[model samples]
Target: MVSLAPYVLKRPWLTKMLTPAANWYASASGYRQLGLRYDDLLEEENEAVQIALKRLSAKEAYERVYRIRRSVQCSYTHKLLPKDQWTKPEEDVPYLRSILAQVEAELAEKDALDSMTVIKKH
Candidate 1:
């Protein structure tokens, strides 16, 4: 709930100052080299993430599975994907983020409704 992300993102100067460092960290993380997007590395044990995964389009779901499988294969072999096959910076998008956000929002709404305290002001 408490994060500096929104504050930094809202300020153009702060975002500009951090963009290069963020990019550098992403590049250094090696998931791109394994052909996996940042979202692909998310923990599936989460309830909201499970809901989000179920909501993915069939094509997107297939690609997600393929990427995970390929990354697992690479891990087993102790090798990265070929340079050409490595995920480009532009291709490393957060495909699951929006869906996950939606799912989390819905869950939060459900919890609020379930715990509602209706006051009778007779």
Candidate 2:
């Protein structure tokens, strides 16, 4: 599956571009009152996720554990997508099937647009 997380992190400005439309409060959650910049938000989220991992107490079980927060960039991001939103992937956990479905749908759309170059060469 193609993950959008890396793309967003590489282009940090995308966060700024997305923020004007975001209803920031809900996005900030516990760190809401810090008055942090978008970059700072990454740090705050990383800390929270680290704490959660510690709570699990299984950090040593994995050679590497990385927690990445993707999706729901803003307070406006509410309401989970309906299961029917996705067509379903063959190898996907029932819990994660919706995510795979959404990503697959997006990849399909991008592929189609790229295929239609609209050119005629002699």
Candidate 3:
């Protein structure tokens, strides 16, 4: 609830004239790097990501989304898909059809996640 400046100022060891001010400013700057306000700075990053159900083009937007997801190890490739094999496993039509079903299921799950993320927040 308290701002960084006052908190830093209260600690004598952390304060020496403008040093506390500078330190607080630097700390706040780091929060800005994380796209946070100083007062809301310590809140979970996931808290903000549940903003809204923005529309997206499938392939290109998907690439961007997965890049960020992979950056955070939250993508299917990071979680479920393996390094050696992705897409339909090397199998006959029935096997491939089952794999396609699983893929569709995964895609639907991802969509449901993205859609429902904002429900509570909204």
- What C-alpha lDDT values do all the predictions have? 0.95, 0.40, 0.41
Candidate closest to the true structure, highest TM-score? 1
TM-score of 1: 0.91
lDDT of 3 by residue, 1-122 (tens): 55686776798776677775665665445322322223232222432222211222356345545434443453333453343322222211121233334555667788898888444654
TM-scores of the models, in the given order?
0.91, 0.23, 0.21
Off by over 4 Å in 2: 1-93, 119-122
Local error of candidate 3 at residue 101 (angstroms)? 0.2
Q: Write the per-residue lDDT of candidate 1 for residues 35-111, one digit (tens) a residue.
A: 99999989999999999999999999999999999999999999999999999989988889999999999999999
TM-score of 2: 0.23
- CA RMSD per model (angstroms): 1.6, 17.4, 19.9
Better lDDT candidate (1, 3): 1
Q: Candidate 1, which segments miss by more than 4 Å at Cα? A: 118-122
Q: Write the per-residue lDDT of candidate 2 for residues 21-118, one digit (tens) a residue.
A: 45444443532222222222332244433443333335521311221221233224643334443222222113223433465566678889988877
Candidate 2 least-lDDT 10 residues:
61-70
If candidate 1 were superposed on the true structure by all CA atoms, what would the RMSD be? Answer: 1.6
Off by over 4 Å in 3: 1-93, 119-122
> Where's the lowest-lDDT run of ten residues in candidate 3?
87-96
